[model samples]
Target: MKSFAPKFVWFDGRYVRDSEANVSVMTHAIHYGTSVFEGLRGYWNSKNLNIFRLEDHVKRFRNSGKVYSITLRFTDRQISDAITALCRKNNARQSCYIRPFYFVGRYGINLHVTEKSPTHAAIVMFPFGDLFNRNGISAGISSWRRINDSSTPPLAKMGGNYLNSILATQEGKRNGYDEAILLDHLGNISEAPGENIFLVRDGKMITPPSSSSALEGITRSSVIEIARDLGYDTVEREIPRTEIYFSDEVFLTGTAAEITPITSVDGKPVGNGKAGRITQKIRNVYSDIAMGRNKKYSRWITPVY
Candidate 1:
């Protein structure tokens, strides 16, 4: 784990030094986790810097804010521009991760915030590399189950919801596993700590549907599209835990995780126990797209510079 300190961060209304961008201790988001955020990646391709699915990320950010009753002071285009400006100001000429967050800034203990309660938005960019082992990762079925929509909406990228993920991930790490795959309340496969899970069987790609309490990930959607373009059939349905152990291949997808192959689940080898042919093909094509080498999916990348 290397430290990454960016030169500038897009604060409430302007760029500020990384150290100057501070939040109050009594902030509502810190107390009750009432915040919405988005995670995206920007790739430096020679002289051209590109951000993947920038608009889609912004849209999700706005939607999450709306769901959580956190009003964003800026529009989608404004936020997008601010992120790009922040990256350029930091002189980030390499692959970096972008985080845009909206939170309740005012101090109060009450769950209901008044109009006087301030809302703040910030964008930060920093150098980020692989989030998981690229070779292959081992995962365990977590003891902690996935939270259902009735409690807190899992679809929104809310900060509070990640506490569940944190618990599950910590449990996996303690058990000598690379990651954790959480099952929904009904015992059906949901997703990993921070990524969507997919299993290949008989050459068809299968993943848990949104109804199964899985986050609607942008990268997951991209994988489905890419797989279809590669002449593979994709299905969205409830997955059983045992199915993963018996599947021909397994993988996870997300903004941070990207496309990570799951070699084993709960100590059981997935098929041959190595990255399968389908997973490798998808990973290679995804890498090409991220590096601006795939013109077929050029629209997915937004030029920042």
Candidate 2:
């Protein structure tokens, strides 16, 4: 989905007009990708917008910075407040995506970054919608292997690490696919370019473990919890590539992708080549939970009026 042009953004410590929220070309993050970021979604109900899983996203945002020694200038609570305030400042009345990030700034040509290094933080929000076909989409098994913990920690949502995702996505699009499914170094199912993968067989949900190079996705965890709450079993293990072709259902989960089913993988139709029953059920319930329609999951949402 296209992001709406925002009117204002939270830059450093205060809100600024979008045009004024600027970064230098020589910034450390631009040159060396020395930045950490997080993306969370806000859903608009009839009354107000709800920022889904704000606290969890903020905690992960902080952890991502810690992995790279990029300490944010703001505390977790301050960051969360900034995200909510940015939404209000932007007059976000529709569903939107929120990005809270910190980057190494003005440390010219420095390979070794320390906590004392200059840094900048900002929060931006814009109108967003479904990233992919929520009904179902085709996927290609990308030749690009996922970046592993040995080279870079997959758990950390660092900007440089996404080069791997970029390559996989490029290859997938070139090969006539809606998204890319990358395999781990060992040729096991890892995840989509920007989302986590789940396989259903024998009425159970299966996904690759974080050890297999999959990010510990917040949406993936939420899907597991929702599935288990619905009485479906969930498992985390290394999945062979061939198993996906045989699974009863396959879907991807992320803050952006949400819960999108895979109707076909590499031209082979999955199950009946349509969104599966369980996937539809989970997606429906997830939409409700995120949109403030499900009071039982009210704790997962923070309303921004």
Candidate 3:
């Protein structure tokens, strides 16, 4: 995987070189993981560039900050504008990923937070391609269980919560799997390390509900809407682990994962072990919409130039 090396990063209240952006070692978010962030994708189509769901991503970033008590000084629109300006400044005329994050910069070990706690926000954009192999990926049912809401809010895109994901993903990689599917506290299917899981059975699409310890993914929401627009039935309910083994198709959705198909689970092939017809259709439609090729879903995009 290539590292992000953008020319300029929107740091604090100004655009600075990537080398100039730095945070204190004692920053609360660095030590205690007191931070919230969001990921967005920008697609370059021919001569036009557009960001997918820029407003929605910014709104979620603000909401995530609120949950962690890390208040952002800028409004949602301001943050969105900053991201657009940063992307343009970088001259990113290709598919790229944008990460907007706000973190606690106060130097302290105290658990108690206050409004005076230093909060810092930055937007970084860089050229990015498929996070996972396009052919398909193999997955394993991880031994690690998803953390419950009582432990930490799963809905919030917090930095600390990713520790659980790190463990699960590492376990998968060590065991010769492309990804890990984590179960909830009650041994029910939750989601993947960095994406939401969806299964297709008998031509119907189903995914775990919000109560199942899955992060409410923006791409996941987009998939559901696109599926409906394509006249496919979608359902949100509790999915058992065994259901994946028998499902006809399995895939993951997220800003990074996009719509990656999972051909097998725990060494068992899903149906014929290839991307299902419905999954391919949804993927194509999503790609078209994200790249500004679909006029019907153009409202979902925010053009950068």
Candidate-wise lDDT, in order = 0.90, 0.93, 0.90
Per-residue lDDT of candidate 2, residues 100-177 (tens digit): 889999998988999889999998887888899778999999999999998888899999999999999999999999
Kindly list the per-residue Cα lDDT of model 3 for residues 135-229, writing each as its tens digit. Answer: 68999999999988988889999999999999999999999999999999999999999999999999899999989999989899999999999
RMSD of each: 1.8, 1.5, 1.8
Q: Give the candidates in order of TM-score, highest first.
A: 2, 3, 1
The sequence of per-residue lDDT tens digits that candidate 1 reaches over residues 1-305 is 34446889898879998789898898889989988899999988778778999999999998987776778899888998998888878877778999999899866887776444688999888898899989899999999999988888899999999999999999999999999999999999999989999999999999999889999999999999999999997899998778887799999999999999999898988888898899999999998998889999999998877
Per-model TM against the reference: 0.96, 0.98, 0.97
Q: Model 2: number of clashes?
A: 0
Please state the error at residue 287 of candidate 1 in Å: 1.0
Q: Report how far off residue 184 is in candidate 2 (Å).
A: 0.7
Which portions of model 3 show Cα errors greater than 4 Å?
A: 1-5
